[model samples]
Target chain A: MIRIQGLRKFFGRQPVLRGVDLDVATGEIMIVIGRSGGGKSVLLKHMLGLLRPDAGAVVVDGTDITKLRGAALEAVRRRYGVVFQGGALFDSMSVFDNVAFPLREKTALGAGDIAQRVEEKLAQVGLVDMGHKNPAEISGGMRKRVAIARALVTEPEIVFFDEPTTGLDPILVNTIHHLIQDLHRTFRFTAVMVSHEIPEIFEIADRVAMLHEGVIIETGDARGIQNSTNPIVQQFIHGAVEGAHHVA
Target chain B: MTDWSAGRETWPLPARWVEALGEGTLYLVESIGRFGRFLGQAVALVFIPPLKFRRLAGRVYFVGFKSLTIVILTGAFTGMALGLQVFLTLQRVGSEAFVGPAVGIALVRELGPVLTAVFVTGLAGSALTAELGIMRITEQIDAFMVMALNPMRYLVVPAILAGIITFPMLTAIFDVAGIYGGYLVAVMLLGTSPGTYFGQMQAFADMTDVMVGFWKSLCFGGLVPWVCTYKGFHCGHGAEGVSRATTEAVVLSCVLILIFNYFLGSVLP
Candidate 1:
């Protein structure tokens, strides 16, 4: 569903993504794992067309998003749903309003129809009857669920989760992961998630790609990645303190 | 950007200074270009179809109605102060009756719009900037973008439209309140004849003066939101970034209003 070829990005003198090449198949949950600040988010932004790459093309479905601009790019982006790391809920809005925002703004759907869809998504995320509450009034876990419900309300063809379970408690992390897995099974949208929840990610991801120093070091199924011989991948998945993955 | 200081002993001071001057000039030009484009986009979007009436109405309530009290109170006090000072000076020259014309002209042509703009900038403009800055920092803006929504259309157009609609109306109110304030001080507090005060003010303050204030207020209304929204939309990283953007938005907006007022004052009839 997505193809990125020879992608390159630079931040001043420091290079973030140096010719990264990857492809994600349709209806697959591809989780990209990397150490903190290892350009994982940068790579994700490039794919979302939020940041233009210095070189290379990002082909989503069949269109080269890099060449699209303004309304054309926006038209393509309508098919995407993004769950930001912090949930990024509009604080001024109630949870229901937040979820209904996309439908109200983009679709010609009646308010009744929008409400029905929002309520359905909210229930799927286990957030029933929580619509009246504001995002600030909810717990961290509930806020994440609200974000998910908001993203899914539009029934997008693809969903990008930027560390959806980050900053959550262990049990909540598992809950969110399970929720994502369950939703993926039902929606069957192409998923590209940037996360670091090693063992847990292995359970959910159809395929795992390990990023190191601006390149994909390895891409394989959960068992294949676990049994890989790449020292860098081994050190990262094992959380080794000292190994081929240098600290400094 | 080569480090001239690395070879300071060999590099001439004049050359270094020239390079720094060139860089500063380029930076200023770039900043002006960016601001001009942002303003153009914002203004153009305000006229686009599917005008966000709901958002605009909410912003008008926040920017216009909420600011009414401060605008009126400040206008009244400024007029009173001007009236008292002018009356005292004219008393020495046996021309205290002309204090009405002086205060009336000042408020209608200058003070009304200028003070109103500054007050609105301090109140609504700062809040708009901080709100947008927070949205940018928290990735809400990014969320909007990924949802195929135009943040400029949803957020900026309403603010600019609100400013354009509110500033002049508020200035007109300010001028009326200020004129009454002058009457309270000169005709009631002091001993100036009421007929003379009203007559001289009516004769001196024409529609031209009133229009000048109106135009100035209209221009200021657009300027505040233009500068403020740009700052917030392009604001830096976190809480500290939002704080800095808010400060810069207020200071830049107030300064621009004053500067624009001077030019408008000099050129307008």
Candidate 2:
């Protein structure tokens, strides 16, 4: 459902995504694992049209999102939900309002209907009673769930998780993983996740893409990622200090 | 609201005025530079490669409609107060008849324009800065670019257009209310002839004076939001940084309106 070809992006003079390419099919959860500052999040932003590639195209379900503009692009964006890292909830709005934002902004849903859908999505994220609370008032786990509920409020065809479990505790991380698995099974939507927690990868990924030095060196099924002979993959998965995946 | 001990005030007599004038002048220059940038983008929107009219209209409504209630409220109360204060001060001379010309001239030539602009700067200016600052620190502006939308067209142009359309109307409301407040003070409190009061207003009030005030007000309206949004968009850091930018926006807008009033008034005979 997503195709990115020869994607290149840079922040000022530093080249981030250097000619990367990848594709994922419908109803599959594709996890991208890489070290910090390795262009994983940059790659995700490019796919969402939240950041443009310096060269090439990011096609979501056949539309070249890099070419879409203004309301048209916003319309395209409404097709997918995004769970931003740190759960970038609006501080001024309540949890219910935060989840209802995309629906309110992008759709013509009446107040009662929006309230109903927001309640249902909040329940799915196990945040039933927390809707009245502000984002700062909630726990990190609950905040992440609020973010998830907000993302799903639009009933998007695809979802992007930008390091969903990065700041959570181990127990909350498992909760998020189970939630991801359950949602993937329940919603049957494509999931493009950026993560580094190795064990969590085994539980949630249908396929894994390994990004190294601004390139995707390996792309394989869940089991393929585990047994691959590529030295970079071995060093990374085993937490080894000496290998093709060098420190610094 | 009137706490004298919130923070220490160390400014001496001569130094205080100097700081006020200096800070006011510095903000005027900075505000002009930012306003230039906004005008450049807004003007370019007229001839740009791709024009987004609907998005631009939405932004205009944001700048104009959302700010309506505040502008009107400030105008009404300010007019009433100016009317009462100026009449009482002039009552000692027993030339209370001059109250008509005094109120009309102040409202039409200087006070009305300057006060409304300052009020808007405090109201719309701060909001603009905070809104854009949050968007900047959060990378929403970057997100717009990623979506291949020009931030200039989608954001700045509409605000400028709205200010142009809204400020003149607000100033007119200010002028009418201010003069009426003066009448209430003159006829009711000081027992002046209503006929002579209004007749003097009609005689002294020139089209030139009213026209210049409205024109200057429109210019201030555009300048305030333009500078506020520009500063916010280019701000550094997160919440604290955004908050500082907002404070500066409000302070600078008030200063610039006064500065613009002097220059624009100088040009008006």
On TM-score, the candidate that comes out on top is: 1
| Model 1 lDDT tens row, B188-228 | 99978899999999888899999999999999989999999
For the candidates in turn, chain A alone yields TM-scores of 0.99, 0.97
Off by over 4 Å in 2: A108-110, A228-235, A238-248, B1-107, B122-124, B139-202, B230-269
Q: Give the worst 10-residue stretch by lDDT in candidate 2 chain B.
A: B1-10
Give per-model TM-scores: 0.95, 0.70
Index of the highest-lDDT prediction: 1
Tens digits of lDDT, candidate 2, A109-216 = 999999999999999999888888998899889988888887777777888898988888899999998998998898888999999988678888999999987899
- Name the docking class for model 2: incorrect
- Model 2 lDDT, residue B267, Cα: 85
Per-residue lDDT of model 2, residues B1-269, tens digit only:
13332332675678767766887899989867876766786777858655566756675676666766776666666666776776788778867677788788888889887887777777777887888888777655653443334667656766666677777777888788778777776777667789878888788887988888888878987888677777787777878999899988888778878788889898877
Q: lDDT values of the candidates?
A: 0.92, 0.80
